[model samples]
Target: MQRAITAIYRTRDVAHLVRDELERLGLARHHITVIHKDVRTADPNAADTSGTVDPADGIVPAVGTAGGAYVGAGMVPGAYMGAMPGYGLGMPAYSEADLVYADAFDALHDLHLPEEDTRTYQQAIRNGDYVVSVEVDEDADIARIQEVMRRPEDVHDLTELDKTYRDAVYAPRRRPPREGYRDGMMGRRADLQNSPTTRDYIREEPLWPKGGTA
Candidate 1:
């Protein structure tokens, strides 16, 4: 089994340099995977006129919106977390953490890394730098590639790669609150409950009546 030796680079230039060197050292170019931030590909939510829905769209995104429904509400101990049948409060888009992981591990399953290194490579790319992972069949190749890619100022292992990436990318920055606009779960719930039509329905029949006022 081949082991993956991976490192993160601060720049695409250096990442390409190391990749070329790895090829010269006898590793095949196809054996190396380069991961970097691509602005064009970053926005999965970008308007898609293509009409093809990504399968992941159903899995990861639906988890949040459907979580409440799956858990159930009204008399259930965890009612607050669950959605009622008619309650269409809202669903959240993907979070930064989930998207980062998804992007970092894109197509990684096909690379066939050794079991131990799979975890290492997955965690190393979370910082969002140009990450390179090469499948080397020999221990000697791992040593050579590491030497070729290691920077004098950094630790060379995953830790230093993560540090370099964090320094380069500022992530999960707070979006400026919408001025005078309600947002987030509370806002969405309030909007749903207060809508003229929904308000009438809730008042007349109430999906989950509180204190017999329905």
Candidate 2:
């Protein structure tokens, strides 16, 4: 089986997360190499199933060697990192999910999709969708997604994504602020207005005991 590593993140947390996922998926530590780009298609035979294997992810690793190592939050199946044809943009792509397979490299690219449907790509474009070449130069494989977007004349205020995000942000809080302590805590006035004991003490002053006048 061919092996590779791709770090689809800038921070160590992302690297760790991908590593954990790979390990969880049964890719051995030795079979893994870490870098900044996906390398599933460098070889005509090697493959990536993460849905982001692009033609520009640099060179292919030798069979049994980890392909490429990198990190990114948008690393999805069939994600093609680097730049490619017909984009007409100056900045390169930032996010690309490497779709690895046991057979060969499959490319995924934006531009072909409508502006809205290609969000994950736009996010990568704006962000530093990292692609560090380990054993080869990165090439963003350009592939098109075959999905239909259903635009409506009305707004979708009830989208699940919106609801979930709002729920997470504005959910009823579990606990409230501390309460239950409001008494005199100040100065000469506090002495007069404070605890019942303090009032009693003041009333029994020696100079004016009970109803006695001096």
Candidate 3:
């Protein structure tokens, strides 16, 4: 069965690094996706539309409108216009940011994740955090991808976040600290290094695939 494993990162750079590492692990680039806020925009709520993956190469294209206008495809009309009044008179009705947010939300919803979890991730992206999702078939691949994502120094596991939210909302209970929490917030590299399949795959595949440089 195919399933998605998603996590949150503090920055776009770290999210990209995680994606690259996943690709190095023999996961297809198209199976991975990253959504984050557009730092170039002064508005914190604006999302980066360029983060959408191109179906041709599974890469985020460097495309954007010149004056903060949305001009590409997959736009959701009136997605945000209804929320803000007076947008029907002279405005473009929807900004590029609005379209991207709608796209991001739609992408996350397609994963079939829980409604609250999806909303939580959307809010995180709106708050400028990066969300990286990987689609996997085999259980081993799921484990491998999760290991790679969590190996990042400051990545947050979505499952853990969900658990924390549930615990806070339902019952406050004492929970043990996460593994490697005391080790300067660094993930355990030894775990991945110890995996025989991971070692062999890393040896077989070039870190950078042909046709592009990471």
Candidate 4:
């Protein structure tokens, strides 16, 4: 598995490039994951022409007529502000404006957060914008292989998720995202809590041992 945190390639055609690279590296197609990068902007004219973005120097400012306006983000300004120590003998520590437009640009371009799940800046992130885009588990071929024992992962010892990672890293609850909505403090949504599916599945899993002869 290629576990290194390497972009290896940056392009609008990231999905295609990733598939090609995995084949070149002689890895099974099922093992590759392409971290996509998508840009959101209201102005079409100002979007970069070449589709080339330099991570270090790219300007993520919402520079429009007067002040930049970001779509899908309700962050006009003054939403988030923090202090910054001024660089002078007696000067006071200046503060960072709650500039949502500026922050989005920096997060996507500067931090190379083209597509990640959690945002380092939230209110900046509207409650419903596609920030990070991860492809749904496109490992169907791998799953099929495993079912036939060509690959074996289903019957291993109980391997629970990491406590810290699951409890905290996963936003709503210890459950997976597709599990459904969760309530305050991250409990399962009431409708699904003690669901019949859960109750039935636990008692009816395909876990019986086969009869054997010596």
Residue pairs in candidate 1 whose N, alpha carbon or C atoms collide under 3 angstroms = 68-82, 68-83, 69-83
lDDT of 4: 0.24
TM-score of 1: 0.41
Query: What is the total number of backbone clashes in candidate 2?
Result: 57
What TM-score does model 4 achieve against the real structure?
Answer: 0.21
Which one is best on lDDT?
A: 3
Poorest 10 consecutive residues by lDDT, candidate 3: 169-178
lDDT of 1 at 28: 56
Least lDDT summed over 10 consecutive residues: which range in candidate 2? 142-151
TM-score of each: 0.41, 0.20, 0.50, 0.21
Write one digit per residue (lDDT tens) for candidate 4, span 1-214.
1011112222334334434444454443323223222332233334433233222222222211111223233432232221123312332221233232333433333222212222321222322121221111222233222222211211111112112122321111111111121221121112221211110001111111122100
Angstrom error of the Cα, residue 54, model 2: value is 13
Is 2 or 3 the stronger prediction by TM-score?
3
Which lDDT values do the candidates have, in the order given? 0.37, 0.24, 0.46, 0.24
- TM-score-superior candidate, 1 or 4: 1
RMSD of each: 21.6, 30.7, 14.5, 17.8
lDDT of 1 by residue, 64-89 (tens): 11111111111222122222242223
> Per-residue CA lDDT of candidate 2, range 150-189, in tens?
1122111122322333323111111111122112111111
